[model samples]
Target: MYVAVKGGERAIDNAHAWLAEERRGAPDVVELSVEQIREQLAIAVNRVMAEGSLYDPDLAALAIKQARGDMIEAVFLMRAYRTTLPRFGTTFPVDTGQMRCVRRVSATFKDLPGGQILGPTFDYTHRLLDFKLAAEGDVTLAPEATEAAPEVPHVTEFLNSEGLIEEECRTDAEPPDLTREPLETPASRALRLQTLTRGDEGFLLSMAYSTQRGYGRNHAFVGELRIGVVSVEMDIPELGFSIAIGEIELTECETVNQFKGSKTEPPQFTRGYGLVFGQSERKSISMALVDRALRWKELGEDDSGAPAQDEEFVLYHADNVQATGFLEHIKLPHYVDFQSELELVRKLRREVAAKDEVT
Candidate 1:
């Protein structure tokens, strides 16, 4: 306390240098290659991409490494990077119906026109830790496929054919970008789905779980979950027609929720939709359930005063990056305010003592 605090600039520079060093780790140790991080730590990359709303795997991987594997911090990094990117023209809605599926499954039906494929999942794995991964990893060969299968149509399409679920109208309307536009009340299904897609995975999961636990229970079943690469098309004004822009991996979930018949209309099963970047089934499923819960007003269901049913609460607080930034910012600097409060408390204490003495 007695020594004068000098070298503020140098101290800041040193701190930055130390931080960079810490991020990189030992010089002698093998550095984590970006490819390694993308392939091996795909879940982290998926979370970053989903929350960041940016699809670059390499950048997500780099951000994950720089953030020291903190998913929220990685998402923050990706979001920061995303803000600086120049906007290209928007793409037409992805034709998920035509997606070349890597994995497709349905919980509502045992078998459908397109057979269920388990694909790649850790769902059946035991909780035990694998010690072999701590040492040099063993490479495994790719499994050979024995048969070719027909393309799987969406499960909701089957329901649509029978007119069981509400028919979704196809439109030429462009959906609002949540990143560019401020979220307004009474959001469209597109906007709501967009918010939920990038929402905090754990938070959405808990909210979805709450729905099953009877807080505004919708009795949701995974009507269909599909993961695959889909063609992204854009309308070139000059060409006067849409053309393929690029392809991206996506996870799409559709949930069937119970609906009560209203006075005007017959009770039919309603749909909740969730679509996200990459192969994130869990997050997508959670998003679908939460989406349904938020649709209470639109579906003419009573507002049950549940957190999941609150659109503002769910949409605003769902992003882990925003939550973490606001929550952790308190650690930055508040000493001046604290000192003022401390002085006020001390003054009040002295006045109380003086009053006691007089008494």
Candidate 2:
């Protein structure tokens, strides 16, 4: 292929101009507002915030709009934006037990302390697409309960009472941040969880599906799935008090998996925890399944050599920005490299033909 000798800057500028025009599409159509994307296309914003590791919904929404609804691109933008900001004091770990739950469901128990709430789910909705909603409609939702759920009793707490599940331990050890440090093999459970929470949803979904397909089968039951807003508090050293910073929506999933006791330990059910920003139930649940599958070695079980179980493989390839950069770099100029390969291939062919003729 012929390589362009010049005009890299000019070509780039023109391409960007065309892209900008394309992004706007036809000006005749009503432009979509950032608020519309924030409130209406909330799932996209949630995914961006979760993957981007930022909790600002408005900023996330703006990123989504600027990225033209491309979630990975939005996440990329948010991550880039996040680096420019100064790090204030660290917030206390959110108390999910006291979360004002918008939705709570448990497969383990039909009747728990808090009854199953099927709130704001599409589980019962038909898959058929409605053409009527193509243009925005002025339909209003009927008001229901104004009262918030006081507290959600954890599903694991019940199993823990009888020693049926693994205990949830609180650790003050600061988890190593992958962004700030290079990821090492045999990662700590805390670090692994941090990676999984920010991992690509599609990748996690596939990894979880592989487990069900006998890749690393761990019989998992969704012990609890809760989506709600939780208060974020930070301890102020000067004030000598903890103050509420803000509230952010979170989707937390706890998957209980069957485990037979190893030679060193007694049999007990294991738990995989997934806590992500916003109402990302599917991603959160998928994360939990994958999280459980990765714990085989730590639990004293044999390594099944599954892709999800490989910390190096999952953590490295899970970031879309990193993956996409290497992927998209293929489209850039490779003339010199291609020409070298081409000449080598032709030289080998000529040698082979000459040897055949001589023979």
Candidate 3:
């Protein structure tokens, strides 16, 4: 058996010093700034914030920079730092209905009260590489003409009018925090949504894709996808009223799934919901689809046994940091365990040889 080596401290120290130098790159090269990351790499920052469960753009950008653009690592940094902060109070539930939207679209309806406002989106952009950015450090663009967008009513509202959709309910129930408590199976709807919102985007996306490929297809359409800022308020016990604390940019998606019915109830459209920080439409929509798939039990649908439909499976595996930690731990020292297994295998081989000789 191989013996364990001693004294790794010096090597570890030297390795860290080398890592620091590598992270900084060459002395002659210009370093990336946190502000640049916050502004230019806003999508990355948004993802960090979403998974980190902390909405500070500046902090998220700093985490991204410190992590060297490893998004899951950045999220880990933000989440770890957030634990040092003390909670002052909880904010009242955000009213997405009052959100002043930048982008609003409906796949179900042709025209709504507010015309489709296509904000800064690359949905229709040609994906061809723009080499102009290589020569020019920065390019100025003409100012956009602004027109006030009218209030957009939710597409689900139209379905509700005809009683063809499940009734939306907002309860005054307190949600269980996964961060604060151990995760339990058969999770509540609120907990499931919370987990999905902070889940690894890529994992969630892949799971949602699986459903689309007929694993547990729910036939979801983007009833409405909106991104905008909404005011956050907090109740002051002494003041006996709630006051506006600040505003946060959020992306909200409401998905209309296939109709569900039984002999007792009429067929009505089911709903899936997703909300996240910043302009993460893809994540939001994917989240909604996955959410609806997980709600198969409540909707009286058969369990297709899809991964996304498995609450325990999805919730347990959705955290990238946790998954990476367990997965990457294989790189650590396992000499003792390996040696034990080696001895067992050798003993078994010896026994087999003896038995063969006897035969």
Candidate 4:
């Protein structure tokens, strides 16, 4: 481990102590509990979990509190903490078709098999803030539904039946883990999906928006967007059967983009898929769009030279943790490097002045 020099250790320690004091805020105000952050600031906690690639809400909330609500910093903390976790057996792929959906909607259809469920959404709410919340901090409970929720089929299943949309088949091939392996060029769809799931939401959103603005337009229609909890199951060697490990909330988006047809094959609607942890509709939708844009070559479409279409660019810069670390490193002590540059500049100026005088 590297040790700080020239009283830098004491300064660093003092800074940390001061940071903790600031995080605590005024002593008069009640200290925010981890449970409160996990429950009330749930969206923020969700974002941290999604980007951190960890599913523990409590840990994410703790990271958020420790980082003083700086999202990138919280994500960095979560990621760093995640590295210390011991390896566990992987769970079977979650069947989202069996999701106990809290929110489900389809832009492609007026009504689908499961019907639209606008569960606890802010879509209809006005932009104005509620002053009552600031004063009272309480809201009435929502009315319970009298009827049981119905089973929902995937929106793409309708298009697939009509032989309009391309079919997706299950594969036994193991997918590359972005966290465990070095990302390579020409990544598989699975690898790409893994990267996009944990990618910076803002970067993906910007790239997706660019596509809608005609940078590399695919004319995407949100076939379905669903948020819910799905059971995670793992096979036990001794038990000889898969058992439920737990449940995780996920947001899944499926986008039907412009069709691709070739001389050998008939035209079929292309698809882009996004699945992320928590109820992040915006992130899931943006991920779907960017996923489609990056599939130009795979879908046999012409590359319009769009930034989103560039896989290397998207994958390399999508990780906020890596990006922030590199960017923040320049803020650290660089006195030696700056001094060398300063000396070089001064010598160059003196040499130029001496030459001018001689001439």
**CA lDDT of each prediction against the hidden true structure:** 0.86, 0.88, 0.89, 0.91
Off by over 4 Å in 2: 1-5, 145-147
Residue 37, model 1, lDDT: 97
Tens digit of per-residue lDDT, candidate 1, span 1-359: 11224766677778889998998899999998889999988877988999899999999999999888988888989989999999878887778888888788898889887788777778788989988778878856558763323457899888888878877755668888899988887788888888888889999999999989988888988999988888889989998998998889899999987787676657788898888888888899999999889988877889899889998888888878778879988876576799999999999999999999999
Which digits, one per residue and each the tens of the lDDT, describe model 2 over residues 1-359? 22264877777778789978887789997888889889998999999999999988899999988888788899999999998999877888899999888889999988998888887889898999977687768756748754557787888899999999988767889878776777777788888888889989999999999898988889899999999889999999999999998898899999999999898778999999899999999999999998898888878988889887887888788778778779988988898999999999999999999999999
For model 1, the run of ten residues with the poorest summed lDDT:
1-10
**2 versus 3: better TM-score goes to:** 2
Between candidates 2 and 4, the lDDT winner: 4
Ranking by lDDT: 4, 3, 2, 1
Off by over 4 Å in 1: 1-6, 135-137, 145-150, 169-171, 354-359
Give one digit per residue, the lDDT tens place, for model 4 in 1-359.
11356777787789889999999999999999999999999999999999999999999999999999999999999999999999879999999999888888899999787789888789999999988898966677778863425558999999999989987856999888888998998999899988998999999999999999999988999999998889999999999999998999999999998776866557888899999999899999999999989988877788899999999999999999999989988987787899999999999999999999999
Residue ranges of candidate 4 with Cα displaced over 4 Å: 1-3, 145-148
Q: How close to the true structure is residue 3 of candidate 3, measured as C-alpha lDDT? A: 25
Give the winner by lDDT: 4
Question: Where does candidate 1 clash, by residue pair?
Answer: none
- Superposed on all Cα atoms, the candidates' RMSDs to the truth, in angstroms, are 2.9, 1.9, 2.3, 1.7
Prediction 2 global C-alpha lDDT: 0.88
Looking at candidate 4, what is the lDDT of residue 58?
100
TM-score order of candidates, best first?
4, 2, 3, 1
